[model samples]
Target chain A: MRNYQEILDTLIDVSKHPLRQVKEFKARTGHKAIGCFPEYVPSELVYAAGMFPVGLWGGSVENSRAKEYVPAFCCYVLMSDLEYGLNGTYKDIDAVIIPSLCDTLKCLGQNFKVAVPSIKHIQFTYPQMRKIEAGVTFLESEYGRVLAALEEICGTKVTDKAISEAINVFNDNRRALRRFVGLASEHTDVITPVIRHAVIKSGFFMEKPQHTALVNELCDALSALPVSKKGKRVLLTGIMADDDAMLNILTDNGLAIAVDDLAQETRQFRYDVPSEGGSAMHRLAMWWQIFEGCSLAYDPEKKRIDMILEDVDKYDAKGVIVCMMKFCDPEEYDYPLLKDALEKKGVPCLYMEIDQKAEAQAQTRIQAFSEIL
Target chain B: MYTIGIDIGSTACKAVALKDGKEIVGSSIIQTGTGTSGPGRVYEDVFKAAGLMPEGVSRIVVTGYGRLTFEKADNQISELSCHAKGVHFLMPQARTIIDIGGQDAKALKLSPAGTLTGFVMNDKCAAGTGRFLDVMAKILEVDVGELAELSSRSTERISISNVCTVFAESEVISQLAAGKKREDIAAGIHMSVANRVAGLARRVGIEPDVVLTGGVAQNLGVIRAMSEILEMNILPAPMPQLTGALGAAIFAYDEAIKLK
Candidate 1:
């Protein structure tokens, strides 16, 4: 029997250094890797092109040069990514795909093109008028452009069958991840919040099918065990929760993440591509249209509150924690509204400001919030 | 029985002891000089003032930025929770709180019972904090404690719109070089901090009877600016620096009784 510790340790290492993982995947498989920035970017097209869709959720990098291109008010993730791209850290990527989701992202997309001249940037906008035929129609056209861009960069013709297969692989991967999140919370002793994040984040570095296989195995190992720990089960919502420091603090405070609405984690996989839709490209576009509840992705009706309330109930979570990303306009704008609605329902929510540096203040905040829970 | 709480802000450390969980027996506030020794020094100082032995304390709770490092604490709470708890205990009618400490500023809304309803903290910047004013005071060759008085005497208030502390400092220097009065520049700094904090308060939807705590609560200039901007009378805690420690002591007492 494979030890879960060994498996998780190996995966955590993979998730920690995505650039090295991408280079390794490229060297081992003799294939190219494409960069996908945070929030939403349809990686299925890249996967269908027989390439790795490497997630570029920013890290602790030197932001000195990034200031030359973008303002300091941008989110930490974008700043780090800009720093890497400008400094040639991401020079090896064949093409970078950016989803111009919010204001900062839109500016970053333009800056990336000018700064990283060597890499091809496949930029597309996700329609905010989703939930309507017009939105789907616009997104389908956008997907077509992205498909063409991928074909141009990869110098290979991607077929309908290949995309359909890629969609199936992603759907299965999403199911496994969705299942494993619940299992991780149940078996917090075995799968701490850090370990769970590692297991989920590693998927962005590997092929979708391979990720699915590993997650299924992890779920099996977790389910075979008893509830090894007891604590407050809470839902985490934010752009990203990849900070190991923050996760360790949560563990110390005895708060288990029952599930997350983080864009870097479950939020990326929540909506599976609909197979009943027209073409694989259409289905991929339909996936974006059907997606809801992210601070990004534009919901005029603000259904995220309902989704969060529903998630708390469904997961039997005691409360919600907002890993508030620093300088993220969309998330910042939604915070007051989200808090107001949560207050009305008498639900407890705590906001922790996340940034590049790990401050000692976060520990006290997390501990205090956990006490109330 | 005695209950103790220690608060470690970025600039200073505070210790407070409560007897029977009602009256504050004693409190001490001093700079967080160097390392692990600050908590111990403040602890001893508070104990000496109370004329009590530390061994008799029923429980000890710690809150603030350095609370996690205070190993002697029986319980640790967030500065946000501690501030709310302390203000609730100090001024029972305080439904909102604005606390400006060493590293950051926060505006927290509370229930009539003093429970924290919601809060908005400063972004990852030093502008809306005591540290921001300290740097500006140093630049102007003035003591930080005297900034409120200096600004109050300003004939005309200048505008310091930059939110970044480093930029704000440079802007202040240029303004001085551009023949701007130090008092007016000081007033601008106060307005800048006040506006930033007031924006945070509005985000949390300030309720009536707001209480102000932390080191900045003692600054009358900031208080005046906050009043003008928030358009509400912001009350200050009698000993704003020890509020977090007091709140922790309250929690320590409550938890101690429950355990017994």
Candidate 2:
């Protein structure tokens, strides 16, 4: 019998039969599918609704077809979706939920609804300001409404118990995920490239049983592995940055991404306290705090300064790489403030902007930035 | 017999009525928006101040931030394209246009024949724009409008380094700490913005006869500083702030004729 680690490694090594594997998994499962972007996509809630939550990465840069449809200054999210839709990769999607995190995203959703007539799309206009009590109440209602709609579509009951169970599963999975990230930071030899790939795939894609198995294997493998060299651990700030190849770019230049303070990842997931115990809205309050807590969500330069310091110290990081997306006005506005804060605190940071069309310029800059780091 | 253009800026509305599209019949500048009221109310006040009837105008074009809010506009054009068109109309030989407004600034490069080639805008940051100068001027206890003339008269341009508005504000305080002359620092700030705008134009290749429009164009100091940086003559059109409205009016006239 294959070990859990071996199973994950096989799932990750998709060059041989990725489509066949995905098709097989889809065929066996009778789960409802929900598509979501990085921001405000609560996968745990989706799982509670008895639906499969697929984290949409938009599309690949190799597909030049997206360039013709969207302008150079438009958000990469729109272009990626267009590419994904036109390329027939998203044919199996039942519904896509978009968050109005920015003007570009708002416009992108409207246009996407028009372009893809077949898919059911819903836009959630999130409040820009997150701190006040009024904002949290608004968000809780919106979350409740979205869950109800999701239940109607999936034909499943999303009881508070189910939500609690889903949260526990996710919390367990997060522990496993943290172990993998820690393993990467430690540069353990046993956590091979293949295993890492398997870990990410299973962590992001798998629902319950498969997800648990994958996590267990990952944790076990990580526990057994010896720590490698102490390198410049970096926390990536700004934009949902998977597509820009920043990880490959950084790792190639002797920089290891120990963690990401992305709006999509750690920022959206709050510490789930029982909603009924003390305040009856503790979880909702925590959710709003999570958004406010994230440095990426707003122009909290001091918060970013503090978060960067915390991440750097925790990961033994040498510096930070602010990965800005082109035409991202908010990040651009905050970059200087963060830069000042970082500089004053004696932590070095570099600002690099990238679009979907990764070019030679990005490569050269990454090389230079790494040397400086 | 005359075409009218109205530019409802953040602080004021500048109206220019031109006879035969070349001669200025009446031009009036007034405080904009009437203390948070819409431009429509302010427009009525401006027309009354000019002693002109609403029907006396053959065609009207509105532009600026409040352009869309105006109900009587024949055509509404983007400030970027309008600034370019307005500059091109004034200085036909001009190849580059730089318009610095309250919230944003744009550097536009026009083809020899007055068509847009390329442009760069600073909408993300308050630095290197009119807003920066305004804040600095307030700190200096002077009107923002006067900084242009005062800076131009300075013997030399000083350096106000730092791109972030927050940092730049601190930088200004530091300059004060160092006992630097206020006029020289003001001149330096203009030079800094001019440098940024010039750099943007240089990316697309700057041409001769660079026209400066928008509210900042009224500042002769910045224009001179920009000219010094580009090593080219900086031409200011008559009623530069109204250029967007003028360009919009031109488009409106053309559209009306096409319909006829």
Candidate 3:
């Protein structure tokens, strides 16, 4: 128990101060580090290029400087990333890889390129028709483009075998993360929502292998405990739900997160990159093809709600709580429809806006939802 | 046994004491003060009015933005659920409830039994809330309480379309400089708030017997504008601001009965 607490506490500290982790990783490994934006990016390629891929999900920062480049209507995640770029917060990093997954991100790439000329910016647009063979071809081209940009920074040739090895390591990390999420739901008393988020989020900063090992140990420790009856079982959905304030509120209200469809968490790892394909680049592109039912990705039938219901039944959740990030239109567009679909089937739900800053009202919303359950 | 429910809102605090879970024996509304101590102040005021002390209450359920901060609350509920329940109790026919409070605007769908079936809330912006009305009233040099009457007297309607409170204030300043009439702009501000809230209500599918609760429901101008925009008669709760407190009181009564 002492050993597990030490390991989890260290990882949570790393999540709290990301720049410290970046400096430590650079000093410890003597390897170069680069930044990768959230939702989906070809981090495996960066790993193959002999550099750590630091995930940038934009922490709680009061930034008005980003408004000079982007509108206030843009999501805080994108705006905060832009703010970090302009404010020299990420100046120590070599380069940044921005994926044009949504409209805000698409525009962010251009703004970063024009505004921050010091850091090299690599941008790529994922194929919208990602379920077809041609989509596979398109993704391969995109990965190849990013790979070339990475090679220029690493000053090393990224061979197919290097990428293949990187894929195995990342696949291990993903599997371990999925395992921890499942284990944490049963032992929420030990793994609290904030700790669960920290353990998952710390994976973004650490090397893929070390992260998996720590989580794999945490999972082993938690597997021995009986199911915790500390909180109500509920599923979370939306862009990102790592807001510590909201997590604490859930803890106070006795709401245990049974599962989630958040872009920053399970949505990123719900599948793995197929190891066998034309090349490592093609396999990297294939991850996008297998992805579906996310607000960021295009799903013509809009089947996200059905997938959420599946989690609800699987986790035996009483209801769903959507931590809708403020100013995110893509997620906003889906809420009414998702609510209608869930309620028609007798599933209950609560909607609370997750802004960058915490407010008492958001806490009340969570408390009320839990009270009803 | 008497049960109590208290709601500490952003701008005001309201509480209700119920007898036998069906009658409102005592109720009080007061402006919110600083910190986690506001709910207790309103609770005392209500208890005195009800001719009962804290010992007489069997259960206490608190709801609203400041709910968790209330130290004496036995249970905490959400303003959305509370409003839905309060409206259902006030008007049984209400299937949809729209609440515009100090800093939020929400649309909640309720079953006939008053359970929250579906709902939606504005995303951290104050354009459609009571705070926006207060700011607009400040700009128009009229009391916030009187602007509702002034808005109703406008001869020609003006439109204020910005959905951000800060930007809307600037737009109002520009309109004032542009020689727009105060009554017209006041009417436009109410219409803008109405239009924004009406959008949220429609998304939740506004059914007949739509009830309005919270502080903004007291403004006749917003209710009139919403009635025009939604093309349905808007039913205001008897004491709109107290509905959340009343709902909490109902929950307290239910909890006490279950314990028995």
Candidate 4:
């Protein structure tokens, strides 16, 4: 049986190597890109629409471009938008979707339309969920608008049969993703580092069909592998841990992130409100109602904190990690209370504020925190 | 020698030129950017109006929200320290300071020698800031600059209860729909902001001789309503916004002399 440490070490070695040629090759194709900013971005829809869905990670912290557009108060949201708009790193993207999660992104959308005039802009204007029908109708209208926009840009109309088929494929990918998550919980001795990297990369690289097959195969293969040494599991809470380098550092430090409550993935996959027997618009609205369970769709401050606790216990996490983006007010307000409550429940909680760029300091801090656990 | 202070706040820039600890020139006014330009640009406007070159300015101090952002400063001081200094400079008997700026409101306590004793700051929301008043004025279809005069003329006192500016704007419209006089609503908005500021003061315990500063200090209605709520006579410095800048300039002077 392959040792888990050996597998992780090999993966780390691969991650550290130069990949300029690989990235240059990918960029050479002039990919039809669609960028999604954080938690609940429905990559499935983007894929079904025949556009490469790229997760906009923004840029590094030093001399950040985000500070120019957004106030010093909203650091994280500004950085992500700045990465695409100010720096022009995501120049390949034809269009982008920004959800009205909080004031930060709302302001970013309002400002960016004026700041960057080249790209198509769509804001998923969220509805108050107190009224079910009204909320669904609002969501359906938004999805229809997005779909219509995507069809125009991509030059391909999405038939109902096409959407239903795409949903099935995405559902399979979700099931496979779930299996991988389950394996991580079971203390797997060996994880397909290729698949782990591919699953995340697919959000950037391939269209839906190719990514689904690649990820599904990896999960099926990993599930068949035997169990290894079970390390302390940790549940990460807060904005999607944007620091890839930091994640690598933490994994290297023997802190296996068995589960994470990323704003992006958790918000996207957790809810599946089927398009009921009503009109296509009604079905789309139903999908949004289900997706709204993720905090990115709405301000689920109290609910999300409680949900984090639930996930921690359900995953049997040894500790909780709350990764905050500097200048993010809502998370900052929610964090202290969550930290105190988690600590009270005898859970070791570590809070770290990261800038847009994940630097060596973040890695060092995560390494240090992981050592404590 | 004049000790000049400048505060590049969120919404306005303030400048004060003090000679022998007596104010010689001072001004508090709107930022020319109208809301888009940075705090540094606002300070440039302040300096331009004062007709003072950056090099000619001696013992320069800076304070307030954009204090750190403006690098061309002799020294930077916290708004708390500057508020204390401004209050001490204006009214030597002042023991408390209440400030409402663009997006934040703070209440500070001062020792006899102008040392900061303690303070409470509301940095989270715009509930008690001048922005709240501006929003209320927009709903009333009046210029925000004229709000103080309009509010002061009201004989009937109406209550504006909503804390959130979005909700408060809606409430103000509803009050208008209900045939409430604009002056009554304007006065009520002042009372609401004053009530919030008073709550902030209550956190650190209101002290006597309270000095009010920041852009909102120019609003007579807010000062009058706050005075009534706290039951203390509020004293405002000649150029309230410049207190932070003056505080920053003072720190710069101290540093320069120490180096000498």
Clashing pairs in 2: none
lDDT value, residue B139 of candidate 4: 88
TM-score pick, better of 1 and 3: 3
Give the fraction of reference interface contacts each candidate recovers.
0.43, 0.00, 0.67, 0.00
Model 3 chain A poorest ten-residue lDDT run: A359-368
For candidate 2, what is the DockQ-based docking class? incorrect
Among all candidates shown, the one with the greatest TM-score:
3
Against the native complex, each candidate's DockQ, computed on alpha carbons, is: 0.45, 0.01, 0.55, 0.02
Residues A1-373, candidate 1, lDDT per residue (tens digit)?
4677777877888887788888888889888889998878888899999889998887887699989988877889999988988888897788889988998889999999998888888899888788888999899898889889998877899998999999999899999998988788678777878888899999988878778888888778777788764678888998888788989988899898888889888888887999776888888888877888888878888898788889888887887898889888889888888787777877789888888866556776677678667
Q: Which has the greatest DockQ?
A: 3
* Per-residue lDDT of model 4, residues A3-122, tens digit only: 434444433443333133224434765435777765445555666776666666454444365567677666664555664575665565677887666778778877667667687777
Tens-digit per-residue lDDT, B100-138, candidate 3: 988888888888787887777776678899999999999
Greater-lDDT candidate between 1 and 4: 1
In order of listing, the candidates' clash counts read 0, 0, 1, 12
- What local lDDT score does residue B162 receive in model 3, on the 0 to 100 scale? 46
TM-score (0 to 1) of chain B for each candidate: 0.97, 0.86, 0.97, 0.88
TM-score: model 3, chain A: 0.97
